[model samples]
Each structure stands twice: as C-alpha cells, then as structure tokens.
Target: MTRDDLAGMLGEQTTACGPARDALMAGGDFVVWDGPVPAGQLARTYRMRLRRTQRRGQPTLALAATVDRLLEAEEELLRIGQIVAADSSWTFMLFLNAAATEVLACTGVARIGTCPWTWCA
Candidate 1:
C-alpha cells in the first residue's frame, strides 16, 4: 500500500504503545515484506534480533516489548514493514496484514546507534 494509504489506516489515533501514528504521518522510507511468515517465525525473528542487540549492549527494552506483543498477536499479522524517520533518529516497525485493512501493532525504537535491521539505518 501507498504511504498515504497506510497513514489513512493509522488515521489520527495515538497509540499508547510504541510510536504514535504521527511518526508514519511525518514521512520516511517505507517498505513492506509480504508474509504469512510461517506460524511463529515473525516473533522468532524479532526475538533473535533483540537477543543479538542485547549482546552488543544496545538498549532493547522497547523492541523486546514489541516482540512480546507480536507473540501475543502473531496469528493476526500477515505482513511486516518499517518506517524510518527522515533524519534516521527513530523507527517504527509495523505489523499488519497484506491487504492493509488493519495495523495489528507497532513499536518505535530510537536509532541511537547502529540498528540491527539494515533497512532502519
């Protein structure tokens, strides 16, 4: 889906967890990977990445929390994507279905140092 389309889906609501919808609205690079990513793969991938980040001494609390949320709602998400700030100061990982009907969850993490995900860099 287009950026504006994703923004429209996020609407004007502010979420208590992760980044607010405004982050996506503010603009950035957006890319989505098509998925139904097996069953537990999504959470597994994030967990592995979080662990790797932890090994390097990067703060991973936000991402870890996000991963937990992903585990809770893993079945509903069919695709995954990210929005990196224009200045590359932060990123928001978006979990949703391919059809773009809903955004199941999102998490924002500061890009204080090298991000494990190259796309966020």
Candidate 2:
C-alpha cells in the first residue's frame, strides 16, 4: 500500500527519518515478503514517522501494527514497533486488544496475551 493508504489505515500520517518514504514512493521498497516461518506478508523496508504532541509534557504514543509487519524479519519487526513507539516517547503503543496497532488509550480493545509481536492478526 502507498503511504497515503497507510495513513488512512492508521488514521495518521507516517514520517520516515530519512528517505525511506521517498524510496518507497519511488517503488521496490514497499514490496511484501512472504515465507513459511510466519505465514504472513510484510513490507520490505519503509521508513516512516507518526507524530502526535503530548499534553503538557505527557508522552506521545504511536504504534506499528503487527499485521503491518507480519512478514518482516524478527529484528526488523521489533525495530518497527520500537521506532514507532519510542519515536512518540513510548506513547504510540498502548497494547490494547493484544494488537500491535491496537494501541492503548487510543483503542479501547483489551489486550489478550502478553505476546507483543503477533496477536491482533
């Protein structure tokens, strides 16, 4: 999906630290990788930033949905989640509905298992 599509998916704009978004826009960077291990698909490498201001010094929260990165390498999967969460000062991921994207506070869905990697999908 395109960046605009992703924005619509998450209901926010995505910002990449470098040229990740630009590269993906140019093509070949957002290809889906599928394999037998995870039985899912993932975008190869797409750099993005999603920013939300905190309320009076409160930390901002953002997240990378597990389903979004389901097919990525283990490290990459973790990297995406951390990047989105940490970039927003740990406010991005709320762990609701056991979904990586089911951020806490934002979504009222209760988290199920403790697994942070794959649960929503």
The sequence of per-residue lDDT tens digits that candidate 1 reaches over residues 1-121 is: 7877777666322241234356666777877777656325778887877776676665432566667767876666467777877777777777776565776656665675667363354
Q: How close is candidate 2 to the true structure, as a TM-score?
A: 0.20
Per-structure clash totals for the candidates: 0, 11
lDDT of 2 by residue, 8-31 (tens): 234323222122222223341222
Please report, in order, the local distance difference test score of every candidate based on alpha carbons: 0.63, 0.25
How far residue 58's Cα lies from its native spot in candidate 1, in Å, is 2.8
Please, what is the TM-score per model?
0.68, 0.20
Candidate 1 residue pairs in clash (backbone atoms < 3 Å): none
Q: Output candidate 1 Cα RMSD.
A: 3.9
